[model samples]
Target: MFIVSLIFFVLFLPSVSVSYANTLFLHIEGKNDTLSIYAETGTQTKSYQVKRLQDIEALYPLLQRRQIDRNSFEQLLRELGIEVFEPIHTFIESSSEIGFVMAENLVKLPLDLLYVKEIPLFLQKPITYSFTKINSQNLQFSNTLSALIISDKTADPENGTYFLKKLLPSSAEYYDIKDINLTQLESIQTKDVILISAHGRIRFDNNDCIGLGDEQISPSHLARLSPKLVYLDSC
Candidate 1:
């Protein structure tokens, strides 16, 4: 009787372990409230709601072409809300251990990251985004370049101070405007590059975007100063 009982316990032990291991619980926090999604060993407890269905549908053929498994493909479909005609068994012959491991270990459900692949989509599509490197190429042009940083003590003191440090290099001659006065403008005589790092609005007439200062310098005032390159850091 003892030997029979031992064999039975060993046979049931693996199933019990797998049952506990396969269960995955996830919590997701949204703007107003929180939500949860649970999944078992080859199935999901809840369905995923997709905002942009068209883009995901367009990409379905590509996923099928790659021959991903039924569970994974279905999971992707549910999350992305795209339909696939092919059977799960035909597409994915064998399930991946790596995929299972990843799914089992995932404590946090991917919150909008998978669906909203690009964040602040507008910000990412800027016309130009480039950084200046402080090296040999920059050194040769430092003397020819001059910067003007405008700052009021109230708006952004830390950012103004930080920009002042970055723009005021040892090799370059730069100016910081604590107060925008007519005398201050008069002091800068032969400046090549004029960087207006302050909050301002710009107006376009023919082909040029004219810079207008807020409360301090109007559109009429900015029209007076003439510089080859004018960089307005503020909007």
Candidate 2:
């Protein structure tokens, strides 16, 4: 799901003046036939559909490997419903940070590395999202809360994926955050896999919680799901 904190700013580019007008926030929900998109760009709301989810999933590899071509990139954009329309043929689309609210299993996707016509999307779209490799901080997974950093080979998030099953012990499950509540979250046992890659927040006025659609998962509730791996990769 895409949620943007709205703020306005101005910029002067040499002799020309161009300022950020808006941001595109897209929230994709449901599964299979139920899949739908909820998006917002400025005051305008846009809706789009894919020919088949399989058609889009097929392109994930191209993105992960950073092997992009106009055709494949076009397909991804078409399926994603990102397009520029009238009144403006071309416009500056730049952003500092990019965040994505996606399924835990898809967290390994190198979204920041995506490019269009050799230009990175972060510099081309006024959308918010981001990621990178840390030097001192290791990309980790856990069993019994014991640290297990990715090997140098698998740590290449730029060109590869962090295969949890290959790194963790026993079977695992990527919990789907669809209107999930504390009761459902707490029901999870030690054998279950816990990957909370969602929209999280720290409120000075109130206690922090994991934003899950209309619901919120508290830290105390989250502790109930004692799984072998807890990848709390959130924003």
Across residues 83-139, which tens digit of lDDT does each residue of candidate 1 receive? 211112221222221011112222122222132122311122211111210111111
Worst 10 residues of 1 by lDDT: 1-10
The C-alpha TM-scores of every prediction are: 0.31, 0.31
TM-score of 2: 0.31
10 residues in a row with least lDDT, candidate 2: 4-13
Kindly report the root-mean-square deviation of model 2 from the true structure over all alpha carbons. 15.6
Candidate number with greatest TM-score: 1
- For model 1, the local distance difference test gives 0.32
| Candidate 1 TM-score, true structure as reference | 0.31
Best by lDDT: 2
Quantify all predictions' global Cα lDDT against the true fold: 0.32, 0.39
In model 1, which regions exceed 4 Å deviation? 1-122, 125-144, 160-177, 202-215, 218-226
